[model samples]
Target: MIQGFVKTPEVQALLDRASGKTVEGGDDRLKAITRDLVESLMATIVKYDVTESEFWSSIKFFQDGAREFGLIVPGLGLEHFMDLYMDAKDKEAGQSGGTPRTIEGPLYVEGAPLVEGDVDLSDDPDETGTLYMTGQIKGPEGESPDGAILHVWHANSQGFYSHFDPTGAQTPFNNRRRIKIGSDGRYSFHSKMPNGYSVPPGGSTETLLKAIGRHGNRPAHVHFFVEAPGYRALTTQINFGDDPFAKDDFAFATREGLLPVPQRQGDSAYVAFDFELQRSASSDDEVFSARSRAAA
Candidate 1:
């Protein structure tokens, strides 16, 4: 017999393991998913005549990217891919007319201060240009829903998120908050216009981008998460109209309806945006609201 490293047996074994096509024959769902993936990957390897060295080098790149993998996911549009799949499923289920879901970037911090209407989020009093954000949560039937929890956060002017940005470590949970909806499903907050952030320099996330000749910059935006008893929780973001990169977002997260016209009110922006939630039809739909983080 040829060595274990020989190509034919190794390839067949890989396909069997990935497709779960052994005599054991277990887990139909997993096998179906893995079979497609392994088959496509094998086709690419064969068609491109990828060398062993090149394959392992790419694997090493991913291993290094794992250090800051969260930062890399959105850039690759994988996060948005999840949103697209969800949107398609919702459409198939006749679930329509809610705030379009967007990528929930990886910087959400659990347990921010829970407050009532209108709390200032600026860490510095001297922070300029306040943002007055107000919105109501409407149910799938288009009626206001009570007792919805809204979690919101964004980067500061310097393009860094607290707890994630090294320079922002001291400001853990800075500019982040959780607000409870009132009886009318109305919620509001006071904040400075959060600026956009760029991928960290010298990090694997940026290194991958640079290698591909792409700029890794996200436009200024605010993230929102909401969950109600009978409605699906929603996670979305809105981009500032004037951000240079707003229209050319590297992450492909923007939707036409998401950009709101900013009204100026004495060095502050007054934004009135509303969210509509879809009625949960299945446990999978309900999980959308409960799970924001990806699995390990």
Candidate 2:
């Protein structure tokens, strides 16, 4: 037999265990999922013609990524899984449709400019594009929530973000601002029209996409992180309806009701949307503070 390092006892033991399991109902389901995962892993190994060193290097990459997965799952769109589960639980509890929630994205920098009332978010009007977003924050039964705070951010026209962009002098944290709602729970801001941007061409995200022959384009959208005293913290994005890639976001974040209609006027446009927050019987103050810290 041709001896390969992979034929070691450890792998053999795993294979033996996998074979010995007599798959039942739940086991059958698990096997199906495991098969997909294992097949994908094997396909990747073969496609790259990965060597032992390269294989281990990729493993380390995944290990590091796994460590960050907790943060990424919430910030990078996978929180949709929790949303799905929550929807099911809500339906079982007779809760109907409410404002849709979405991924917050990875660019939210804390300590953003805070405005108790509506204000212009385009601090650098010329450098940053122009966008006028208007919306309301409602509680159950469409009632306005008092003192709801809206934290928002977006990418620049060049698709470069603040802190991530090498040209930091032009825009420190491109398109990041926090606007608080008034007693009426209504809010609006004026900013530039952000453009669609891709991930770094040679980074891990790009590398995986390229290997899979997938494009790394994200549709033009705004990020929102909303927090109110007694409501659950909501992290979401609003995709511009006209964006060609809006429905085909590489991040896979587009949701049924998350896309907003944008009406163009003069050189810019207005995007109107509303978010309904779920109120918990027990206060979520601690949860909100923890989320704020994580964003910080």
Candidate 3:
């Protein structure tokens, strides 16, 4: 084993300089986080005795696959970890009992048309498999949250999402909708049954998964962003329990209460589920995060 030198004064000085610890002006939070990150990376390199070639190869992998980082991050469980971390923080702060948050994979597009009451999300005439989903949003005490908005989106039958489908087959906002809930806090939508999909074949996400001896596949699921005036906004999704990948989601988004089995009703599939939202602690909690989202 190579002698570990990351803890030595020489390496410490280098890290401090590299992380801007010696700088006079900068974002303090960023600088501190950077220092910790660089220190950990240096320690890992020393611990693993990583060679220069191996390091550069890893860097080149990221450089080549930068576009797929959104998929890659969730596949690596970083996004799921964020959810888990947030849950723990909430629990520590005495916040409890609500729908579990999960990974909001990087496919959400803003500006979907908002409609009151039940809406039909299926726009393709050629699609045949029909799915009807209905749900109610309630506060922690089982009271309906008045004036809630349910933003929903899902992939098409071919697992291609609108605005990002490489085939150019999907129209704008296909399989996407925003339903307005009244005093009853109920919403519903009808859409085509979405198929489970795998990561882009031979792309960066798939290549990395292959290298790690893992398959990149996600189960059929519907994404939701629910918000109310006095309730904390929720970013969650529900996986079809019957999907083969329901328990083995590559994005690590499958949660215990989020998996709802679909019931067959003649030619269509029906799903009934309910969401519970915690009361907002502040105004900020009543809105979704400010992450960059696609708009069209």
| Number of colliding residue pairs in model 3 | 0
- Candidate scoring better on lDDT of 1 and 3: 3
Q: Which residue pairs does candidate 2 place in steric collision?
A: 129-192, 130-192, 130-193, 131-191
- Angstrom error of the Cα, residue 224, model 1: value is 0.7
- Model 1 lDDT, residue 12, Cα: 70
Q: Model 2 off-target regions past 4 Å?
A: 1-54, 60-79, 92-95, 125-129, 170-174, 285-296
lDDT of 2 by residue, 91-186 (tens): 898766557766655566777777766666655545544788887899888888766788888777777666566566445544777777888888
Which candidate wins on lDDT?
A: 3
Q: What is the TM-score of each candidate against the true structure?
A: 0.87, 0.73, 0.97
For residues 1-296, write the lDDT of model 1, one tens digit per residue.
22332247768787777677774858888887887787777777777778999999989999877867777888888988999998898789787888899988787887788888777776654355878888788886768776688888888767777776675443666688888887788887887667777888898988999999999888888888888777777889888776788888878778888888678777778888988888876656544444455321
**TM-score, model 3 to reference:** 0.97
- lDDT for predicted candidate 1 compared with the true structure: 0.78
The clash count of every prediction, one per candidate, is 0, 4, 0
lDDT values, one for every candidate:
0.78, 0.70, 0.90
State the lDDT at 50 in candidate 1: 82
Q: Write the per-residue lDDT of candidate 3 for residues 8-118, one digit (tens) a residue.
A: 888889988998889899888998899999989878888898999999999999999998999999999999999999999998999999999998899999999999867
- Model 2 misses residue 285 by how many Å? 7.7
Which 10 consecutive positions of candidate 1 have the poorest summed lDDT? 287-296
